[model samples]
Target: MDSEVAREQALDAAEKLFYGRGVQAVGMDAVRTASGLSLKRLYQLFPAKEELVVAYLERRDLRWRGRIAEHVERHDDPQERIPAVFDWLEEWFGEADFRGCAWINSYGELGATSERVVAQVRAHKRAFRDYLAGLVTDAGLADVLAGQLFLLAEGAMVTAGITGSAEPAAEAREAARSLSRAN
Candidate 1:
């Protein structure tokens, strides 16, 4: 396979392994086996597992945010759009391989020891918060409202991940609605 296809195959395997099993739990050999790539090829593409982890996180962040943006854009009203984020979360939580926020999970697993992982997770979260901030601004709400919404959404992700239920999304949406009105 060419570099692009090889890279994608490697990332696909890495995402499944890293997100399904904690990042530290799986080794490059597992990714190599899963991707059907030789050790030489895997090392050539990734150089290091840390590099592969960064790539995995970057790809996942892009896809996750893109999906949420698509879901939110289905509504024209800002009020409706904000809640649509939770609606998206609810759907995501119900997925067969859902394992909470990948960034959060990666951070919990390796943030302290791995600078690349830490930076990737922080960037992902900052971007998410910024997305909510834009929504809050569009809704004509105070700037602080975005932070509150971010907290609610993150809390829901954690809760849903732990409890293996999507109910937290709805619960967070309700709390977010109350925050919207109070602001």
Candidate 2:
């Protein structure tokens, strides 16, 4: 196969394996098997397992943010857009394969040992926070409200992941509504 095709296939496999199983638990051999690529081709595409992990994370980050943005964009009201984010989260959390935030899960597994993984996690989080800040600003809310909303969303993700329920997203949405009103 061509380089691009091979690389995408490898990444597809990596995402499934790493996200379904913890990054640390899934090995390169598993990725190669899942991708249907030869060991040598897999290595050529991803020089190391860490490189593959980073690529998986980068791709997931774009898709995850895009999904939330798409859902938020459905709201005509700026204030409503903020809570729409939680609505998207609730939908995602309801997925049968839902395993919580990919970045957070990867960070828990690899952040302490891998600087590259740590960087990816931080970048995803910063981008998310900045997105929330923009939403708050668009709604004529104080900058601090963005931070508060960010914390609420993050906490909800953690709670939902741990409890394996979508209740946290609804709870966070209500809290966000209350905070927006106060602001």
Candidate 3:
């Protein structure tokens, strides 16, 4: 297989295994098997499991944020766009393979042991918050409201992940509505 194709396959397998299971639980051999890449090729693509995990996270971050952006941008109203984010989350939480936030899961498992993992997690979170900040600004809401919404969304993700229900997204959306009004 072409190196880029092999790399994408490896990352796809890594995202599935790492997100569904945990970073530490899934081994590189499993990734190789899933990707149908030879061990040598897998190692050639990802020198270490950490490299694979980071690559998986980086790719996931783009896709995840892109999905949210697509959903939110569907709204013509900037104010409506804010709540649309929760709508996206609710849909995502309802997925059969719904696992918690990949970044959060990775951070919980490997943050202390791996600086690179920690960096990926932090960068993902910061980007998420910044995205919220942009939405809040565009909606003419106070800057502080962005932080409040960010916390609400983050809390909702954790709750939905743990309870395996989409209820938290609805709950968070209501709270966000109330908060937006207050602002």
**Per-residue lDDT for 132 in model 1?**
98
Sorted by lDDT (best first), the order is 1, 3, 2
The alpha-carbon lDDT assigned to residue 68 of candidate 2 equals 96
Candidate 2 similarity to native, TM-score: 0.98
TM-score of 1: 0.98
- Which 10 consecutive positions of candidate 2 have the poorest summed lDDT? 15-24
- Name the lDDT value of residue 62 in candidate 1: 97
For every candidate, C-alpha RMSD to the true structure in Å: 0.7, 0.7, 0.6
lDDT of 3 by residue, 1-183 (tens): 789999999998888888898989999889989999999999999999999988999999999999999999999999998899999999999999999899999999998999999999999999999999999999999999999999999999999999999999999999999999998
Score every model by TM-score: 0.98, 0.98, 0.99
Give the per-residue lDDT digits (tens) of candidate 2, residues 1-183.
899999999999999988898898998999999999999999988899999999999999999999999999999999899999999999999999888889999999988899999999999999999999999999999899999999999999999988999999999999999999999
The Cα error of candidate 3 at residue 65, in Å, is 0.4
Q: Identify the runs in model 1 with alpha carbons over 4 angstroms from their true place.
A: none
- The reply for model 3, stretches above 4 Å from the true place, is none
Error of 1 at 21 (Å): 0.9
